[model samples]
Target: MMTEQDTEILIVGGGVGGVSAALAALERGRRVVLTEETDWLGGQLTTQLVPSDEHIRVETTGRNASYARFRDLLRSHYRAFYPLTDEAAADPHLNPGAGWVSPVCVEPRVILSVIDGLLRPFVSAGQLTILLETRPVAVATSWDRIDAVTFETADGAEIVVSASVVLDATELGDLLELGGVEHVTGRESREQTGEPSAADTADLLDMQGVTWCFAIDHRDGEDHTIDRPARYEHFRDWRPSQLHGERILGFERAPEHAGDPARAYLLTPNPDDDPFGIDVDHRNMGGAPELWTYRRILARRQFQPGFFASDVTIVNWPMNDYIGGPLFGTPDAAEHRAAAKELSESLLYWLQTEAPRPDGGAGWPGLRLRPDIAGTADGFAKVPYYRESRRILAERTIVEQDFSVEILGDNAAVSYPDSVGVGHYFWIDRHPSTGGHPGGGGRPQPFEIPLGALIPRRVDNLLAAAKNIGTTQITNGSYRLQPVEWSVGEAAGAIASFAVAGATTPRAVRNDERLLAAFQEDLVAHGAQLRWDSALRW
Candidate 1:
């Protein structure tokens, strides 16, 4: 069957950025059509099985107000519905998982429910339409403007959507390739980008690794081991040069301590330490030398005594990072994705059979997979956790020097006259790549998202909404975080709505001072912070 639809704004990915863009557009009274390849939205936070990775100042400052509200809603949902202890429910800063990664590290399913609730009003009012299990297959373009996009549904139905503005929010930037929007993949050479962290030569296939995350809970004296995967041996003994010949399935791994050699990590579940003893704002408390609590999604201590048997944690460690091939722009994309899943499964098997214990023993056979938490038949997340995307070449490509603290000094970043929003990260964190580029971890200063970065150099009616915005491989490391992505999507959505109302192009909005100021004021009115406060600097 074939169908056609028209809208004011078309968002082609339902990750954090896509949802934010949809809300922003719908609030501005523009009809929106949002599509997602997976059944669930909230890509990294839900389907990808990763919690919100945020900066220390995210709670009070250095973040978009809308993003902050999303966090508050997640916490409020737990307090309102879940069986939290009075102490846990009353704490203003509730760390559900008490995980080191983010303060709001709850299960992926909770995020899906909260996001659906947030979009429910617009959806019922008919101002927003959401299509799940749909992906873009082709793009209609003429004279540097996207005319329409054809999407293939899960059941083989075709739906062609035409919109005045198209936002590319796919995790891998699928539209950039299908629509022929000029984009750059992998690391740019030092000579090209002038980045101190850039490689001497460019390798298009050197993109960061992707992980297939899963959740597990431990039960003592019970065997819940899964059947061994078919390719278990391949991953058990397999290792790339990035790990210095150490098996990736083992506890000792490289990049454990930044600027140091490989170190051993332990697997201790449900330690006796009180989860409430730690302060929410302290980052160091979660950095304990144990694997189980690193990304814990459910801390049993947060509930009443005997309410839960065990804590649930997500397995997204380096052991499962698949760097054998890139997911986009490759013939072996399916093979690579399958291999990544196998790697994660093999890691689980190893943990259940051979992982080291504190009492000088082998295996914890009690580790069980929680498919319900992931909302999938299998325990693995519905989609791989992607770290890099096909970034568009835009009017202004943010570079490493623009925010690297080592180069710009502490509390300093390049000033942008057309700043749309701000984002901050502790470091430029990059995972290993297929092209043998060991991941980088350089400290970074708080940065701004330039309006020019959202506008494609030549595409008239398209915008980069997610990790696909204009940034070099080096700078993408920090800009790709959750809040930053939300900020970018919000800015893109606001720009599209403004362009439609003013009957002007995004380029004209940037080129004309009067239009740019008015557009920025509109963004401010929607609770977006255009710049960071002086007190936020380190």
Candidate 2:
């Protein structure tokens, strides 16, 4: 017999957005049936094992109380489990990784535990039923509403979930296609979006590259070489056409920059390291420093003597990005996926055998991959860190005019009457693009998420709870980051709860000004952020 479930909210995809959505719905007393393709929750945080790539203002401004609490919990976890030095422990703000990229960087498991801890209570009370290692097989839609979602478990059991509201929080917005919801993928025309950074014409299949992040440690004078990848020779000899003439493994310049391209950083060389001062700090990581410390998960100095061997860093750099093709929604999707994974392996090989060392030599033969952290014996993440998703053909697409700091110049972000949440990130970045588009992207202003964006134009009961929200290709870059995705999911969950409680459809609640205001109030009560302050306003 097939497993059948009924809930008020059906949240698909257990990544950051899915987990956040579940939490938000549970907080609102909504019964939820959450499904995850992977056994673990916290997609980017856990399955992908990538450290937080957050904005400098993470400690203050633009973040919600719930996310802030999550950060505090991560710090507390380190203090409780690990042996931290007195200075590191007593410091009110303890960044576990001490990574330069973000204020709160910790192991993926730390976040997984925190998320599971939060979800356990809901599960115990039977308010939330989480189905792990399950993938959605079919979605049934009646007229304009999502009637039910069906999934096939790993053990070959079929499960059907009929819910009042269906939130698509999947990594690649798998629900968008399964439910026959209209969506936009790839680059949008500059004229369509009026985005300065947009391509001149629409390129439907062009999307951001996905990275298979993996963790590694440095053991001086020890050899920890991985078996050379099957496509090692090809990747080793190949050069990136997008980065001028630089080898894929070597220094490269942004397409915008033509000079001698800046060099890639290394674990041993310490070229970007501040020789005399502290290497890790909360400074703007715009230079080589960003690459070097971009994903360092564990800083040995923070712990007591002999507690750690060497600093374990994660490999999620431009060098490992697979721009050969988009992962899903393409004919050769599986091959492209394999190529991306191989690229990551090639990157690890280069770091071990070809990357230049500080001693005027090449390669760090001692560099080793940490399989335990990545949850794979091969050292690659359990899942690729997808940067973009098939976004819903939203009622209101976010244009550059809405959030580009270059355009807004200090003006407050354009306000939305149905604002459900708030977030801030760079506009466009490292797009794994086709047709040799630009590499680095434009800086962006903070932005407000309107309820209209979450509601698909024709899909009555469905909601976009992740990067699948209403955003143009240009806007998707920033909207796809960690914090912003979390906010999007939170907003979706809140909308679902409010709609069920009011006995209204998603469109109806969004259209009613009074109902919309009440929903926003509920978001505030549940620790979701609704707005930024006046300082951000010009």
Candidate 3:
């Protein structure tokens, strides 16, 4: 017999946001159903193979306490399991993947393990159901509410889930399209949102590049080179004119100033191995930095002698950024998806065959693809690292003015009275565009996550739980990070649980000040940071 299960909350994507939402709902004694397209639950961290790219101030400012707990659990797990050197074990903040990108950089699997731990108790209690390798096929919307969502499993079996509240936490906001939620995609004109840094014309296909990141390990005398990708030459020689006319490979980068010429560097040199310097000078500055250590998942220096021969780093660099257009939602989705994958594989091929090395050599054959590390046979990530998503047309659309430092001036960020949570990422650092038009970057300030952003103006029982929240094409750049997504999810989950139990819609909660305040207080109690302090004053 076909299965049709009913739940209190249905989260339609088992990514970082969906996982957070599920945890929040489960904690509230709500029966939750969550589905993921991939086997892995952690999206960018695990399946996408993109290590944490966070701000430097995270050490002092910290994130939502729930996320903090997860981070702590990861470190604690490493401390308990790994054979750490005295020096390594002595340090309190142990970065398993001592990558320069983020202080808490670790392998995707390490994070996946911790996430499993977070869900196990709820799973055992029968409050949560995790459907892996499942995807949303159809949605049953009754007037304004999403009544049921049908998903096809890996085994071709169909499972339908009915819920009071549905959360669209899919990576690309897939449910928005499936459920016919009013959403926007790609570049919005400066006229559309009325903030600086937006394009002059709306280009629906002009979204940020998606990187199909892959992890690798280097062993000197080992040649684990796979077959040369089909389009290796295309990516090697193909540098967008937007890149100021330089090859995609090598240290080639377009100058921050558009009129300036292209520049090349093997990697940003950091003799001190200081992460602060890297974050300020290279990472936050965009372009490219020390390629190898940019997102190293496992640094040999972090472990004891002979424990690791070389570091394992994932390449999500300029060369591999698929800037052809928004592939997931557009008409050319399948064709572009294949091209994106080819672009990544081809970049890897180029790295193994023709990349310039500091040692006065071309290509390092020893740089081997580690399929086992990322849990993918081809060594590429299980999914692409999407920097943008189809955002909902909400009660409030966060434009550049709310957070851009240039526009907001000394304030840098504006506060929302109906705030649900808080997130920090200074600046709108947009990556390469699909049309080969590079977008601008500017640092913003710590921003509030307004509850209105999560509430679709038209949808009654649906809430945006991931990058699908109300954000313009420009503002999406900053709000689309790891911590911000978690905050969004946590808030959505909490609000959904409350709405489901209280017999009200997300819209009702936002409109009612008392209910909103109560929900915010509950979020604060459960580790959702609602606002910044005077110390973070811009």
Which candidate number would show the highest lDDT if scored against the true structure? 1
Off by over 4 Å in 3: 258-262, 267-288
- The residue ranges of model 2 lying beyond 4 angstroms of the native Cα positions read 252-266, 269-283, 290-292
Reference-based TM-score, model 1? 0.97
lDDT by residue for model 1 over 1-32, one digit each (tens)?
Answer: 99999999999999999999998998899999
Would you list the C-alpha lDDT of every candidate in the order shown? 0.89, 0.81, 0.81
lDDT of 3 by residue, 124-165 (tens): 888888999999999999899899999999999999999999
The 10-residue segment of model 2 with minimum total lDDT is: 269-278
- What tens-digit string does per-residue lDDT give for candidate 2 at 1-538? 5978898999999998899889988988999999999989998888988777676666877887888888899999999999998888997878767776677778988898899888999999989999999999899988999899999999899999999999999998899998889998888888888878777788877877788888888777999988889999888777666656667776544434556446554454222343123333433344454454567778777889688877777888878877788888889999999999998888888888887666778888778888888777777799998888898998888887887777878787788888877887644554657556646666666678888888999988999998899998777777888888888999888889888998898789888888877888888887777777857632
lDDT for model 3, please.
0.81
* Minimal lDDT window, size 10, model 3: 268-277
Clashing pairs in 1: none
